[model samples]
Target: MNQQRIDGGARRAVFAPVDNRARVDAVVRRIGDAIELGLLGDGEQLPGESELAGQLGVSTVTLREALMALRQQGLVTTRRGRGGGSFVSLPEVPGEERLKARLRGWSTEELRDLGDHWAALSGAAARLAAERTEPEDLVQLRRTAAELAQADEAAACSRLYGRFHVELAAAAQSARLTREQVALQTEVGALLCLVLGDGEYREEVSERLRFVISAVQDGAHESAREPAERCVRESTARLIALRLTL
Candidate 1:
């Protein structure tokens, strides 16, 4: 993978270990998620053990255990000499056949309910972002969206597309909102990977994303919410259609 394609500030994801319960597991999961989301590139060396532990609020021992688990899972590897540390090792994304099976397992009603919840979260984030975003913060939003639009691989686009919403919540200037959006994205991001390879769907989504960004950039708060909500709804509808085809 070309790290240069994703070399931007948005790719440096911050770790937030809420409450420190099961700290090692939390460290492993967050690092894995960062890799899956394309925020951490393949071959990117992690921070030094102590520094990484501090960032995730885990002890060095806990961090070591987490890194070992990642190594076992093939998600991270360690080196011996100078300029060496644990480095990200991204796995192949699940295949379309596997994704199709996943879609088949979910009822339309269930998927619709999840979409409704996602829409509420994203819709409000877009509205708040349009209303509250500063000129400088818009840069991150545009960068993320542009990254999604330009992503050459389905796996990369899937992660970048999802990250755009999380960035919007951050742009809204509410920490709580940002956290909530991240959590929601984490939950649904895997499902999105299933359909990202479809050129038609990907193009439509790219256009919708740009519309939402334009509305936010123009400070059209009300206009931002509709396209944002519609984007969620339309994407989920396509996924549900995939369910029926299986």
Candidate 2:
């Protein structure tokens, strides 16, 4: 297996049901969402078409069509010959104008709903992380938090910030929880890019992450949940505020 091939573990992190959906679209979404969440890295090789189709429970034809669509969108590239296969080619993050347009389309209630959903997932993950994790399990959590704190670019900060929640869920040692966190982060990660550009706000959020990790390290489940939820809610509030002003 190529080092960059998304292994089975990574594939499981984002795979979802395709039944009752257009097969091509479903395949595209499964692979596309994985890329968006960084489950698949840039220049990563995809599994062989037949193997990938089997894993996805889709026909090879459908999978081919999906890959073609991805190629057209520049999310993937396909080449023939030795050492050539489908490779991830993540596009640049959308401009602020795109983010603004996306946010302007959301209603207040929808914003709140997204916030509540995010809060619930993150809160539960944090609480479980405190209960289930050992001291060493938090190493990645601390590292991801630190990176988010120092990330100077909006896209870099947003990706690292999203990674913190994913790492927290993994520290809980629940595969289901981790996958759900990845899925949630895919959607919320894009939105976060809208607000994560501010250096001061990124630092504030980073400090909050430290507090949450500290609580988890101390095995304070309840304490961890509050700050974790607050961190998510605060980001949502910032996004909503920007939407309101626009």
Candidate 3:
């Protein structure tokens, strides 16, 4: 009987069969979920492949296969040296004109679906920010808001606004929620900067920032959530309209 044996104290175990590809895929999926859920973060190093494999009950080769897939997706990078490991890559924010061009190929429904997701996550973030915010966090939030207001160009405002949302998420004090909020904000801001190329639209964004700040400042968790959701939805709709016109 040719059976692979596992050596453990007093017991040797043999597994019937295992799918290496499936195992690799599972590892990839698990890591992706961790990144999405904020269990992992950009530039954060992952555990050693051998350790991860042991944790997941798989061979190192299987884990390497999964890491390769992530590398292809530009989600993770690996370095071969002392104190080096797989690290999460930061998501890039596309420029306004570039994002607009990209969206020209997407359907209205697809854009709307993106909007819906953004709204739901952002609403939750606002509520959490209001509920958990501290004085120091509020100070940072106000500073970001002020920067957004002072920005002269759409590009500048877009970046500052994105930062404002990040600060709000930090105030929320939940690592998972903050991670989701950051992801959504990055995606939404990239798209919005593209569609909202005019001063009027940016002004609207600033006004929404004001509303968010006020709600969080007053500890109005419920009020903040709805307005944040509305802001995301409204911005999405505005982008859709712009796409239609183009």
Candidate 4:
């Protein structure tokens, strides 16, 4: 597969038009989440201003504002002259201390609620994927699972973990669901590093993802849903446990 097309579904979702009300902020978030999800490669040149603005269905002014914010945050960089354009600058994962502090801000009830919502979204996506997807359509999910298994760093594992669910939503062929998954992942993705950083848990997550893939491939919608929900619930439970410790 071409590197540019490795996560084509996600790449499309990232660049798709933004919600009208939050154009600038929405543009910034969509691209930023894609970077964290590894859907957009570091140093990748983004489309030209006019082209990107058109693709996003936003005015050039809005796009420029969004790009300016991204540059200030170090998530994007710009150069002048020929061949000059915005390029991705992948943000480093938050340090463990910072992640923990952020987690501490969430109450147990909030975490549980988020977990329930996450499980519902993932389960629905998995069931739909099983019914709607063909074997070839599962390539991205399988690749993300494989990468998650091999990832040694917490940040890499967490991003790949979230990417799997995003790809799962894409496999369902629902653009809305895929976008929702992307947004949800950004909400909890970095926090996942706390639990996924454990080598044993990482392997377990890798296996769970494979099971979800197999069930989807076999067209067992309920089977696929079960493991998909389980994965989210398990991660949420672990996070809750860690949260209690704080």
lDDT of each: 0.79, 0.83, 0.73, 0.87
Q: How many steric clashes does model 3 contain? A: 0
Over 4 Å off in model 3, which ranges? 1-97
- From the highest TM-score down, the ranking of the candidates is 2, 4, 1, 3
Q: What is the lDDT of candidate 1?
A: 0.79
Clashing pairs in 4: none
Judged by whole-model lDDT over C-alpha atoms, candidate 2 comes out at 0.83
lDDT per residue for candidate 1 within 44-144, as digits (tens), equals 99999999989888789889998997887677989989978889976565555544544554678978888998898889989989999778978877787
Each prediction's TM-score versus the true structure: 0.62, 0.65, 0.59, 0.64
What is candidate 3's local distance difference test score?
Answer: 0.73
From the highest lDDT down, the ranking of the candidates is: 4, 2, 1, 3
Tens-place lDDT digits, model 4, residues 4-93: 795788788888876544778778767765665567898999999999999989899999999997887677999999988899986575
Residue 4 in candidate 2, Cα distance off native in Å = 63
Q: Cα RMSD (Å) per model? A: 14.1, 11.8, 9.8, 13.4
Tens digit of per-residue lDDT, candidate 2, span 116-207? 98899889989999999897898898899878877898888988988898888888888888898888777677668879988889899999
Count of backbone clashes, every candidate in sequence: 0, 0, 0, 0
For residue 112, give model 3's deviation from the true position in Å.
1.2
Ranked by TM-score, the better of candidates 1 and 4 is: 4
Q: How big is the positional error of residue 128 in model 2, measured in Å on the Cα after superposition? A: 1.0
Best by lDDT: 4
Give candidate 1's error at residue 214 in angstroms: 1.1
